[model samples]
Target: MARFFVSSDHIEYDDAGCAKNVLIKGTDVRHIKDVLRMSVGDTVTLCDSCGNEYVCSISDICNDFITTSVISAARCGSEPRIAIVLCQGIAKGEKMDFIIQKNVELGLNEIIPVLTEHTVVKFANAKDAEKKQIRWQRISEEAAKQCGRGVVPIVGMPDSYKNVIDRITSDDDTSTTLYIMPYENETDRTLKTVLYENKDFLNEGGSIKRICVFIGPEGGFSKKETEYAVSKGFTTVTLGKRILRTETAGMATVAAIRYEIGD
Candidate 1:
């Protein structure tokens, strides 16, 4: 069966707040009616972005929309126990797209494109940045659907390295956040060592809420950039002896974290 994400407003709820039906609109309508050639009585999975999923059977199909009756609803099972956000320095060309797609499949909760000192890609203006953000979001949505994710991971707008540092450092809930950066120069501490050291804190009564992983661009983070981030409470750890590419670094870090601490 196919899976699609539907907004809360398009879902009809009963007295008990259970989903009764769902209305799918926009590009998906055409995909369902023409591309997939699905008809009434066919079933599909609909996720409401709040980690709830509904098994819906098509009841009516229109030119511009599709109505489905909810058969069953439950919390999404594929979500990781701990939320992981990838703070990726924008890679050149299609590398960023590949990174977003693979990381979403590996259960990343969110991604923020960072403009760092060594970042090669530069937007001409704000409009250019916004346009790229929208495209990346679409890629995230598609990846989520393909991997049976209950909620599409968000791709944040491009942000400067300073802004990211400021936001994370200013977070009131610092106790629950594990801020990590993968630095090539950090040889003493390994990622596995860091994860193991924090294992107790991460699992203690479920107190650990979020894990933020920062990956550098092709040229990697400048020495000053890494120093500043480390000073602001971000732990610098080495992934391994060999250096990983910008795209591969995020995926590797995420997969390792999932294997170590995630469901």
Candidate 2:
């Protein structure tokens, strides 16, 4: 079955305000009608970005829209219970695009690109920043759709190294967030061992609220920056004996975590 995500407004209500049918509009009309060549009575999956999903059947297909009658509705099974946030050091060219796509497929909850001391790319103004953010977000959305993700992971505006550290380590933070930074210099604390010691697995099972992984640029994070991050409670861990590129580190860390705790 094909899957799509829509806003709450797409759901139609009965006289008593209960959901009756789903109204799919815009470009998807052509996708179902022409691209996929789906017809009435075909089954499709729809999710209202809030996480509830419906197994719907096409009842009518019009030129402007498609109507789907609800067959069964339930919480999306694909969404991970433990969220993962990737704080990536901005890579140049198509590298960033690859990172965005792979991370979304790995079930990341959010991705933040950061500029560090060795960053190769620089923006002259806010306009450049906004445009890049939009493009990256679109990549994330498309990847989510392609991978059958229940929700598209966020690709946030680029931030500075200091800003990202502060953003994740604040007391006003409602969600339980744990930080992991992979450093080549560190040989003692492997990511696997650190996660096992720091995370819950016995009483509550291997349940993590959120895991934030930081991957520095090609030159890697400065010693001062790594020390400051450690001072702010970020754990410095190792991937292994070998070194990984800026793009490879985030995906590797996320995949390992998902293997450990993700259902």
Candidate 3:
């Protein structure tokens, strides 16, 4: 099924009438009229990012757009049990973009870029940071579409390492409270231990609904930072004995969470 995301404002009402016509604009207009070559009466799926999906049938085609009428509306598609939030130590160059794209596909709920003390790359100015965040957010949207995700994962504005940790500590405890960091020297236990031990932790309507995944930068999290995370109740678990690249850690942790929660 063809799927497109729309703002909640675009969804008027199904109670008003049986058929609701939808007018699409912007880049998606070009995609439907030109790239997809969709014509009048073609069926497609439209979603208001608030989790409502409408089965739509094109009713009219225009020079720059296509108008569709709603066929059905319901909440059918949604992420499964696991809700993962990735707190990644900002990396240099295109690595952050790569991380955002892959992690979104892997079903992460959000990405927080953390500026750590050891981070080598510096944003020369506000313009540079905005450009980088935009690039990463675009990659996340594209990856969401490719993976058939109902919603795009947010690429949050960059924050200091301390600020990121503080936010995690202050968040509600009704969420899944796992914090995974692939440390070099810490090998007390494996990821499998934490995951398998808490197999039933992701029960529906349970307190453990969200998970926090922490991935270090290229140089990895400083010893003091890791200690702070541990003090904040993060488990500081290892992926395995061998060290994985910064790019590999985020995806691996999300996958592990999904596997544990059946997401």
- The candidate that wins on lDDT is 1
TM-score of 1: 0.98
TM per prediction = 0.98, 0.90, 0.90
Local distance difference test, candidate 1: 0.93
Report the C-alpha displacement of residue 92, candidate 3, in angstroms: 2.7
Error (Å) of candidate 1 at residue 260 is 0.6
Ranking by lDDT: 1, 2, 3
Scored by TM-score, the top model is 1
User: On lDDT, who's better, 2 or 3?
Assistant: 2
Q: What are the lDDT scores of the predictions, listed in order?
A: 0.93, 0.86, 0.78
Collision count for each candidate, in order = 0, 0, 0
lDDT of 2 by residue, 1-263 (tens): 88877778989878976667998887778988999999999999888877788889999999998999988788877898878889999998999999999989999999999999989989989999999999998899878888888887999999999998888887554246677899989999999898778656411444447778899999999999999999988899999988999889998999998886634
Report lDDT (Cα) of residue 115, candidate 1. 98
Model 3: CA > 4 A from native: 16-19, 62-65, 173-176
What TM-score does candidate 3 reach?
A: 0.90
lDDT of 1 by residue, 169-232 (tens): 7888688889899999999998899989999877846678899999999999999999899888
